[model samples]
Target: MVTNRLWRTLSAFNCSTRRWAPIPLRNTQSQVTQRLSPTSRKIDTLWTQRLSIISWNIDAFSSRPVSRAKLILSHILEGPKSPDILFLQEVTPDVRASLLDDARVRAAFLVTDAEDQTSFEDVPFATMTLLSSARFAFGLDSQKESDGIEGGENFMLGRISRVALPSKYRRDALYVDIIPPTAPGTFFRLINVHLDSLGDTLHYRTHQMEILANVLREPGCSGGVIAGDFNAISPEDDGLVNKNGLVDAWVALHGGADPDGATWGVGVERRNGLGPGRLDKIAMMGLKAKEMEVLRPGPIEVPRPGEEPVEIPWSDHCGLRCTFTI
Candidate 1:
């Protein structure tokens, strides 16, 4: 496969970014007092008890990944107001390496890779990456019932299951159990995936969807969240969803809203390499969404004036995150 000269060149530059490490999920949390706020709004416990779920395809952390990490820190993980769970798809081995070695990303998340690294030289492919902050516990197997995660005020990292799919790229769905602070005795099941990207065909994707739907239909999936870059438009995705009774967080919150919001396609159709469609998503079986928004890579204004721009994002797809009321 041919690599993009621009990306190849930019990847060579030394990249660095900072982020908050995972804070352990304690059983108790302060009450949230509000209803709706801005997309970049900090976690306000005064509003109401809610769970923040961020699902992004992330364009394989293409160029200026540090900038993207900063955007995430500023917009999603804002210290005490950070998200409870994070689901990311298309996190390639190189991207994983960047996050592992980068100071910025380490400050924010205690990540659990779905596939364990065997050889140091092996390059991980497109994978469903599951990570977390201080808001929840990690490292245990996903269960249908409440299997209390082991964590204190600061022990949130845990084990994750790598469930594979029947696709040409050998894709997989990652599973992690989380305890949302708001609802007591409830273990939130989080699944992240990147469906077949070989092309717009229903054959392989159909089998993959069947497998995904079955997972969602598991007995212990009441507070389950299934999210990622579905590559779902070609199949209309509804039949499978309806079959499993999963609710689309975007559509549930919007309901014929934001017609122009496209995660993967955006402007690629006019240029016509990928598409102009909404490809990324967050779905759930029993969780309620308080807010959902599509996150894009725009400019971040530096403090000093009359200086060259410090960071620029060139990812092919945009990002999306949703805050759910538990």
Candidate 2:
């Protein structure tokens, strides 16, 4: 059986050596508490707890990936308040290594991919989810089971699961069953996905969405949130949410067709004639969006050791951050 102390070892994958290494632990109590700001702490006292999520496609394929990854991590971690969950896509091996090795990241969140790296090794890049350990406890194996296991204050109960979507590109979705602190004996699914890209691969994305929709409607699921890069480049992409019986967090907070809702191709020059579009999104069922914003709106110049500093948007795509209540 996995003990509470065993979870604290926090094993990380070594991309260079292709081995798993134990990440050194720190004073997790202090580190975890420091991540939340005063306002965030106060907000926690309310009867209904809100879930904050940030979904970004870090664009691992972009130039200076290592440097870009560092910058992206800094921006996300150094923010005034940490998000409850993070859904990142286009994460290359090196990027994944950097994230797992960071002490702050290790202390603050439970990574979905850390324990099962081999399942995704065949893919060039994969999507990753970070669940805030401070706020949530994993559910039992069966959603019909009672509230999370009771033991160490920080012990997470069950495990997270992933589904391989039908994609020519081998894309898949990572999901976790989390018991909300305010609501016991019930759990909601949180999914991280990066659908097939490009304008010609619409059918692949459509099929992937259908499969995810069914997962949300599963017998014991209490409703869930799906967030990540949808690559919604076409007009038909708008209908996927409604057709699947899901609510778009962006549209729920701000109205439809809002220019500010655009999340991709911003501050970056595209070879195609297409302008920026809202490709990354947070879609949900049985949850209400209370606040939403575009993360890392502008570009930054990343300094290269010998070469001139290269200017690029945080990623080819801007990130989407939203807060939802159950």
Candidate 3:
């Protein structure tokens, strides 16, 4: 059971066994078209906005300190290039609170309920989340899994549930139908996932990936994106991260794997966790891609603007942000 802030909600609509309260994160995406002039249609600010999506594992507060969470929010929202559509993994309730409290963050984006929120000590750690601006709206809140969208499923962000997992693993993936304000009928499915950790074998990861592929390839599905901490070192790991005919934006852009693209840290390396591997990722299903960037500014702690004394560590894994010019 996850009880999170509407600042962020702990929801997996299917997790009916757990009772929860929904936090009211305001989203003024729907503003009635007021007539200001004679014979004129009201203009929507988001009509021509291009989506700038991001996927990150902000290193939850359950394991890390809250100060680090604050720094993470600062880098994401305070930076010059904050995202318009963000997909996050490993978000705990405490960290979610920090994110919600950030005046800049709240002013810019509306967050969705995270998966498996409040898991440890009644607080969540390493859960999945998706947040967006007015240009992109969640079709359904996490609480409405598979319930279908009101008005029209075509217009709402439909909820998607997980397909398979090990009996011991109780984690859920973050899936939502993103309806772009500019394109009314076109919906993009976004799945933010965190697979099993290092101890889990290739077979275990492969099973999870296959199940995820099924979710992405559902009938009537137009196009989608799959991203998050994939826990993969290479494309083919005994069928791990089944790709499901999706394109890896990093691989597509760089021709091959680059050391900078690694998202997971391993071993006992103090400077960077596990020596850094491309554990985090962004990929697309049946969609065209334009830009992909691995946003790591060298080492664990990167210097932010005007914060000389503070060299904030971006995260255990660097974030992935991409632009899809569809």
lDDT of each: 0.53, 0.69, 0.55
Clash count of each predicted structure: 26, 0, 16
lDDT of 3 by residue, 23-84 (tens): 43323212112222221122243344345677877776423445666666566666777776
Predicted structure 1: lDDT: 0.53
lDDT of 1 by residue, 1-326 (tens): 11100000112123342222232332311111222221221222453446676776666545555555446545555545456566666565655565555443354344554123431123345543434433444433322112444423322232245554566766666666554443333344677777777455567666766566555444333346778887767545545555555688777778735675677656444544545667787878656877877777555443346776564344556777788764
Top candidate when judged by TM-score against the true structure: 2
How many clashing residue pairs, candidate 2?
Answer: 0
Which candidate should be chosen as best, given lDDT against the real structure?
A: 2
State the lDDT of candidate 2 residue by residue for 1-326, as single tens digits: 11111122132333333333222222211111111111111212245657789888999776867678778778887888578888889988888778777777766566655644564577889887776756654433222222344432322333365556668888877766665544444557788889998988999888778777767665445677999999898889988988888999999888987898888877666677788899988999877899999986445687799999977776888888898886
lDDT of 3 at 88: 70
Predicted structure 2: lDDT: 0.69
- Overall local distance difference test of candidate 3: 0.55
Off by over 4 Å in 3: 1-49, 61-64, 114-124, 138-156, 160-164, 180-186, 234-243, 266-274, 297-314
Clashes of 3: 16
- Which of candidates 2 and 3 is the stronger one according to lDDT? 2
